[model samples]
Target: MFRHAFRRFPLRVFGLVALAFVMANILGGLIGTALAATIGLAVFLPLFLFKILMVLMFFRFLMSFVGGYGPRRPCSRGRIKDRLQEPPAEPTKEETEWREHVRLARKELDELFPDAEQFIE
Candidate 1:
């Protein structure tokens, strides 16, 4: 769908949006070239680092959010202590059998090549 729009109405969709966004800053009437420089830097740096497509999509999502800022939330909600404090679960029967097989393989490997780094344990 977007590929089609990119082929079709680029100016109607993104081109004019970008143009208007830049021009709005240019014509904000007070900031002058400072705002223009900031806008130019934002565009050029993101294009250089992350490439044009990702930067454009980021700007599109930014424009979609109210006042161009999403709602704030904590970076992470969970307490690491909770998980660390929990006891590990017992291994299942299948896991036990798998471990036995691994142990046997390691034993064989040790017998065959004692100098090996021994990965199984």
Candidate 2:
């Protein structure tokens, strides 16, 4: 098991290196080659990504306060009331099973108390 994990470790490392290189190239392309070279790709890449995330989150927070009803809550768009008014075409299998279970429970309770009227009183 240890050997298997070790074997795949190099492949995972290689993938990470490739990803870093790609991100560095993207950073270099967007923000100029000189800046990328000065800051160094390894250190700057994660910081730059974190800054972007923070800026986006800050803007989202600001918008929530600025707006009227920040975002619309999801609601039932269909005629749910009408659907409820209309009876189900047929009792579902689960519903049938539930009814059967309830019946059995009631029967067991009746057996426990032979006189139902005395228990109610």
Candidate 3:
């Protein structure tokens, strides 16, 4: 449903809000790289990634309380489904049977009372 609306956050739509966990943590790498260059701690790659990870952890923890409003509201799923995918136009089994029965009964009545139409004048 929400697959196309938010293509970037597709995984998050399926109720698994923790998929791209490292997304917010990538900053740790940036911090580590900055520190390495400034202080000659030059271990940029590994340590920077780790710093980004810790930052991600902290941010994720904070964001856990903040589930933003998605493209579709929770209450709107049922209503949208109901409106979009309606039943086919063909008659129901019971309705078809009832209509057939009425046709037959009218035919019988016409045959039994053919003269009834003439007396109407």
Which tens-of-lDDT digit does each residue in 1-121 have in candidate 3?
Answer: 6767678576556445444446445677788878778776555667988999999888766665554323344335576678679877899899999999999998999999988887887
For candidate 1, write residues 11-77 as lDDT tens digits. Answer: 6778789989888977785576777889999898976877777878787677556443334422223
Where does candidate 3 stray beyond 4 Å? 1-88, 119-121
* Maximum-TM-score candidate: 2
Better of 2 and 3 by TM-score: 2
Q: Candidate 1, which ten residues in sequence have the lowest lDDT sum?
A: 68-77
**Distance from true location, Cα of 59 in model 2, Å:** 13
Between prediction 1 and prediction 3, the one with superior TM-score is 1
Clashing pairs in 2: none
- After superposing candidate 2 on the true structure, give the runs of residues whose Cα lies further than 4 Å from its correct spot: 1-78, 115-121
Q: What CA root-mean-square deviation does each model show from the true structure?
A: 22.8, 20.7, 30.1
Model 1 misplaced regions, further than 4 Å: 1-79, 115-121
lDDT of prediction 1 = 0.74
RMSD (CA, Å), candidate 3 to true, equals 30.1
Question: Candidate 1, 12: how far from true, in Å?
Answer: 54
- Report how far off residue 23 is in candidate 1 (Å): 52
List lDDT for all candidates, in order. 0.74, 0.80, 0.72
lDDT of 2 by residue, 35-92 (tens): 7677797788899999999998887766666433235412233345567788778988
